[model samples]
Target: MYYKYPNGDEIYNVMAVYEAHEVYGIPRINDDEGLELRYFSLDEPIEELNPFTEYYLRKAGYINKW
Candidate 1:
């Protein structure tokens, strides 16, 4: 996932999001008519994140640091 720098020109990946998908899970809605819906929310409850998670803080490292 990537965030826009207000102007929508700058974009970058946010590892926390990727990790959340692997760890917790993302809500998915499946349709039988050859259509699939995958829902993703960036608003994560603070408690959902690992306390030891230092991605938001580290800034330098957002991958597995969380």
Candidate 2:
């Protein structure tokens, strides 16, 4: 998935695994046609994701330690 800042100055291409069971309780992968990109609003609360996803994003420099 690719996340681009509103200013277009920063962009991040993150590689994430498709987990069907995590999002949906199905055992098989999702069968979709086109690419789907989801954007979050600043007012929206952030949801907790899998540890692997967070690790990769952090390692890729998309996130910084405080």
Candidate 3:
């Protein structure tokens, strides 16, 4: 996905999916209407992940920056 900001700045899309499995790169699910996405996710927690909570955030290994 890709889009230009209101300021007309063209930007690459990026999304950190909780489980960026090889199967999760569908061009549609992460595809937004106007914005782009650099989609990504984990590969091990597909069955153990909780999308309704921050389980992904912590397991994503970026909690130190949080």
Reference-based TM-score of each model: 0.19, 0.33, 0.22
Model 1: which residue pairs collide?
Answer: none
**Model 3 spans > 4 angstroms off:** 20-66
lDDT-superior candidate, 2 or 3: 2
Cα lDDT of candidate 1 equals: 0.47
lDDT of model 2 at residue 13? 61
Tens digit of lDDT per residue, candidate 2, span 1-66?
456678887666656543232253323435685464444322333376556666765577654642
Q: By TM-score, rank the candidates, best first.
A: 2, 3, 1
- Cα deviation at 55, candidate 1, in Å, is 3.4
Q: Identify the candidate with maximal TM-score.
A: 2
Overall local distance difference test of candidate 2: 0.51
Please report, as a residue range, the 10-residue window in candidate 2 with the lowest summed lDDT. Answer: 18-27
CA shift at 63, candidate 1, in angstroms?
Answer: 12
Tens-digit lDDT track for model 1 on 3-60?
5676668665534335344545655656666454343334433445544444553454
lDDT of 2 at 66: 23
Assess candidate 2 and give its TM-score to the true structure.
0.33
Q: Which has the higher TM-score value, candidate number 2 or candidate number 3?
A: 2
lDDT of each: 0.47, 0.51, 0.49
User: Top lDDT: which candidate number?
Assistant: 2
